[model samples]
Structures are given as structure tokens and as C-alpha cells.
Target: MAIPPDIKDSIAKVKPLSQSAVRLMSIMADPDHTVAQIAAVVESDPILTGNVLRVVNSPAFGLRAKISTVARAVSYTGGNMVVGLALHLCASGIFNNPLDGYESQRGSLWRHCLFTAIASREIARFSDGKADPEVAYTAGLLHDIGKAVMSAPLGDSARKIIAIADKGEMPDFVAGEAKAVGTDHPEVGEAIAIHWSLPGPLREVIRHHHAPSKAKEEYRTLVYAVHLGDFIAMMSGTGTGADTMLYLLDHDYRNFVDISAAELEKVILDAGQEYQQVVESMFGSEEEMQ
Candidate 1:
């Protein structure tokens, strides 16, 4: 599966999502945008509106009243959180499809993305980092999108990559991907993010999540959050797919963020419970293996 140089270059030039994602990113950048304005944009896309409301009423928020509209959900959860959560919901279908050799169910990827998004937000809050929780959430959710895309067109190569990864370890898996597919999932995800016209920060986060040290300060934090969140989810036996065996807990990551082992454990524990409730509410099931 030698990757052609042309394909590699083409992938490098890939754009992000269409106008919808770009518009949402623009609104997110505008601090002056009210909840009503943000909700209006989400409402313009009926599917996004419905998903937002579904998330708001889910156990993740624990709202007592049923949220019938995007506006109320945004108002209830605060604009920043709503924006991040909305993006996750809106894009879920795009990444939720089954992949050969991945071992994830129809919506498993979407569930894992949402889990990481929530966990990343909690980590940022606990770290007291200036990082935007919404941005962190979005970065975490889309971190592995490349794997989804690669699985589609390069199914055989993807299987070989996973096979080699399972036989060795995390770095080995990455190496195998580079050897068999010309690039790893992180790079592929970065390419896809760029193809979709996602924000620069997000594109970088997706590119470097597996190697946070390669990113700049802000992007480094985003990558770290996604890395930690994904590690915790994999350990918890939550929708890690065939890639679960490749999971590695990078101890040095805490050196960049100054979080202790005890603190890390707490974040993972709390996130597990939240993950359960959120998954149950969204998919009507708490059993990840089911």
C-alpha cells in the first residue's frame, strides 16, 4: 500500500467542512454573539437544532425541564458549552458509520467523540487553563475523524494498519500506519479538518493529538486534553474499536499541564460516570458492549 506522493500532497491540501462549519466557527469566534443569535444559526439547520435539544435534555446537562428548542438549550447550558455540544451533535452522523475492523457499532464513533468532548471540557475547567472549553471539546470530538475517512476508501490498508498495531503497541501502530497508508490517522484527520475548512486551531489539534509536543502552546493544550480524554475512554472499555489495543497513556502529558496522578484519576473517574449517563440518554443504552 505505497501511498502516491500526489495523493499525499492532495491530502495535505484537504479543506475542512463546508459553509455550515465555517459559519458556526465564525459565530463562535464572535464574543458578542448572543445565545439567541447562535441558536438562530443552529435553528437554520433543523437536524442540528434537534440534536442540540436532544443533548440539552440528556443527563449530561441534568436539566429538569425538557428542552424543546435550541434557544432554550443554549440559554440553559450557556452559549459556549451549547456551541461545542451542538457541533458534536450536528457532526455525529458524519462520523458514526461502521468501519471494518474497527469493532465499533453504528453510532459508536459518535458516542466516543461526544464522550471525549465532554471529558476534555472537564479537564480544561479543572486545569484552570485559559483554553476555551468549547474549542477543547470540539477538538477532542473530531480528533479521530481521519480514521473514519480512511476506513472508507482504504479499507484493506486500514485493516493491515490495525493488525500491525495490535501485534505491537501505540507507536508501533502509528509506524505501521505510516508504512502501510503513507500517514497515520492523526495526519489523515488533520487533512480532513483542513478539507472541511475547520478553524486553524482545530486542524492543528487534530493533527497533533497523538503528538502534542509537536504543537504550539494553545494547540498543545487542545491536543493534550483530547489525548487524555481518549486514553481514559479506551481504558474504561468504551467504544475504543479495534484501535483500543493501541492506546497509550502518555505520562509526560501532565508535565505540560501540571496535573498530578491523583487529579488525573479523579478526572477519569468523574468522566466515566458522566460518560455513562450521557451515552444512556443519547443512545438509550448504558452498555457500551451492546
Candidate 2:
């Protein structure tokens, strides 16, 4: 479905990512780029560098040695996570705001996205090299960004969409959202990805995260990783809004990610803990999120 002209205009006019954030994404897209190169770009931006260090030092990693340099932090945190952190820092305004349309309070979406990122990374580890864990981490981090853009436009229709999904009148919330709004969050997310000139895999993951089966053949594994990561986040109670667990799960994900129930449980438990530490380091305490 074509995004409505109004939403298209909003996307075109949406806040541009910081130059540092854009640079980090560019470096991430380059397979030949070394971690030091990304570290250099990150160190160029003091805020990004400081945030990376903070996340590394957070209880999430439990590193005994304090990471003083951006390079060490980047190496420890993984390049994908540093890129995700840069994106999160640049998009703070969009993420911090409450999604009234989705009935989500402030900070909930950020937590959900962070949880999904960590979970997606863990899921990718079982992909047998079909998916890159770091790339999956970045894709999962950005999978729901379109929701921030779509929230206001969704407005009161959020309830109607939820009702339809709850009653099984629609296949899932994406269908319900498309029925109520001109487009769903994934579609809007693709538009935002285009606006930001994000790489193809990231854009594909964002656009088809709800239906990994529909993504391009090359990106299906990565998209499925994020799709399952989103499911894990929602199941673990880190959902962004009223539509939590309302999306249909594509069971075919097993074809791509070979994880057992026990592994999935472990991923959820570990990701939930990491998500809390990242949130506390970047935003504030868990109590503040509520």
C-alpha cells in the first residue's frame, strides 16, 4: 500500500539523523570496514563515544576492567551495538515521546526496541552463518521506528485496530493498522529508512519484520531473526503498546533460525536483563520508564 501523501510529507520532513549516526551506519554497511574505523567515527562524536562507554561499563557487560577508550568499548560492545547506540542517541526525541495512538507510555517503545535488538542478536547466533548477529542487532533495534512516525496518525484508530485484531477480524495488527490508517508501521518504517538512506538489509528488516516470509530472499533470514526477536520482546512484556502479541507469528521462522524452546527461553531471560541495563545507562531507571 502506498503511504498517504501527508505521512509521506511528514517523513520527508522528519528529523534527519546526526552526521555521526549516518556515518556509523555507512561504515556498518561496508563489510571491509574494521572495528577501529567505526571506533574512529564514534569517537569523533563525544556524545556517541561517551554513551558507548557507559553502555559497556553498565552492569550489562559486567566487565571488571573499565573501558576508557571508544575503541575498547566498540570492541567489547560489538560494532552493531555501537551503531544501534548511535542511532538511539540521534533519535532520542522520537523514541522518548509517548505513543498515545498506540497507548504506550514514554520510554516503552525504546525498551521494546532494545530488547528486540538483544534478542535478535542472540537468535542470529543460531542461524549457522545465514545471518550476521551484529546486523540482526541493528535491524532489530530499528524494526519498530516507524511506530514513532505512525503513532500520531494512528490516533483513536489504535483502539479500533486492536479490537479487530483481538476479535480475529483481521490477520494481525499490521492488517488492522493498514485498514485503519493509510499504511502500517512497517511500511512507514520503510519510508523512514529511505529518508535516512539506511542500507538495504536494514530497510528490508524494518519493512518486513512483521512478515519475514514476504521479505526479499537475501534478507529473509535477517528479517526472520528480527521478527522472532520482536515476538520475544512482546512475550517478555516489553511491548510498545496495545497491540502487543497481536501480530501473527510466522512459524516458518524455524526454517531460518534453528533455536530450541530452551534456547529461546534463555535468550528472553538474558535479553530482558541486558535491556534494563542499557535503558538505565542511556535513559534512566526502570521506574522512570513507567
Candidate 3:
């Protein structure tokens, strides 16, 4: 299926992640990067700096001593959390807006992404350290970004795509999208990731999350981690729209992640609780989220 040219243009027009945010992500992806290095990037952007302090000091962390410096916040919260704050501050427009093609309300996609991030982090814990939980969290946060690009182009056909999935005519909503619209969110997400110059792991995870088995061998574990995370988000009622649980699960995830049924349930519950706190910290208040 060929992606429409207009969608290509839309992908190009999508705002690039801030320079500081990009730098932070790059630094965070390297496990050996120091806290001071990450803090230096966050401190370079005042908005990111304030958000780091705010998130670290938020009730989510329950730190009695207020974090007064970016260095301290980075040290306390870790590079993944600091990078997430930077991305949230810079990409709120992309995250907060409604995906009309999906018939999702404003802010629902962001909530879904946030929930997936937490779930992905938890799920990666079961990966025997083959996959980095921190990277999994960031990948989950941005996994469906292609949906934002595909949304408008898909338009009213989204209903048709949903129908295709519901009637079992397609294997999943992504397949429905391909049959109905000639492309799917994950494909579009790959374009956006490339457009944004996102890290290789992120680009691959965003692209292959729905079909983890199709990912390259080295990346399959991380992709499967995010795939499960995305599923848990939708199952927990934080899906972006009608396509929520319509996607097929790659049961082979057990081979990659080693999460037992009971452990999966615990992850869902714990991640759900963490998601609420993270959302509040990132967005300030429920009112602001809307």
C-alpha cells in the first residue's frame, strides 16, 4: 500500500522536536551518559528545566526535599523521566490534539500514550535486561505518533476501517487501514520518526509495535515490550479511539519478555496507578489536560 503524498507533506509539516529535546533523547539513549550531561541539556531549555523540577517534585516522586536544580532533578528522576518531561513540554501540540480520523477526543491520545509509556516500562522489567525499560517507556510514549499524521488523511474512512476489523475481514485495524486507506498508523509513524530524526530504536519500535515479529532480530524484544504496552493501554480503557483493542496481539511476546499471566496483571494495575500520577505531574491538572 502506498502512502498518499499529502500525508507525506503532513509528516514533513509536523513540528520537529525541540533541539534540546532531541539532544536529551540522544543522550538518554546512550546508557553511559551521565546525569550531569542530561541535566545540562535540560538546563539549556528553561521550559524543560522547570518541567524537570516540577515532575521530580510532583507527588509521583514524593520527594520531601524540593529539587532546586536541573542536575538534582535529573539525578533523582533519571534520564528517561527527564527526557519524557522535555518531550511532553515540546510535543504537547502533537499529543494533546484530537485524532479526528480515529474519532478520538482531545487529550485521549496523550493519556493513552502516557499509560503505554508506564506499561512499557513495567513490561520491559520482565525482559531480563535484554531491553532497556527506560527506552521502552520513551518508545511507548511515541509509538502511535504516526496516527496523528494518518488521522486527517484517513478521514471518514476510519469508520470503514473499523468496520473491516469488527467484521473480521481484516486481521486488525492496521490491516483495515491498509485495505481501506493504502497505509496504516505504524507506517506513518515511521515517517514521522524519520522526519523528527528520532533515535533508531524509537523509529523501529514505532514502526513495528503492531507487528513485533516483523521487526529485526536485535530490536524485536524492545518492540514486543512496546507492543504489549500498547495493548495494555487499550485494555485499560486508555486507547486513542475506535481501533483500541482491534489489533492482534503477538503472543510470541512470551518468548521475548517472559512475563507470566499473574505478573502481567500486576503490571497492568501498577502501571495504571503510575500513569495517573505521571499524567498529573506532566499536565499539571485534569482541567489543563482538557
Q: What's model 1's lDDT at 253?
A: 67
The Cα error of candidate 2 at residue 187, in Å, is 0.6
* Model 1 ranges off by over 4 Å: 1-21, 26-34, 54-69, 77-93, 153-170, 286-290
**What's the candidate order when arranged by decreasing lDDT?**
2, 3, 1
lDDT by residue (113-207, candidate 3, tens digit) is: 88898899899999998888878988998999988878887788878877776777778888878876778999999999999989889999999
If scored against the real structure, what TM-score would every candidate get? 0.79, 0.92, 0.94
In terms of lDDT, model 3 sits at 0.85
Residue pair clashes in candidate 2: none
Winning model by TM-score: 3
Which regions of candidate 2 are displaced past 4 Å? 29-33, 55-67, 288-290
Model 3: runs farther than 4 Å from truth?
59-61
Residue-level lDDT for 125 in candidate 3:
91
Model 3 is weakest, by summed lDDT over 10 consecutive residues, at 278-287
User: Measured by TM-score, how close is model 2 to the native structure?
Assistant: 0.92
- TM-score between model 1 and native: 0.79
C-alpha lDDT of residue 222 in model 2: 91
Tens digits of per-residue lDDT for model 2, 98-217: 999899999888888888989999999999988888788888888998999899888888788877767877888888888888799999999999998888999999999998999999
Each model's lDDT comes to 0.66, 0.86, 0.85
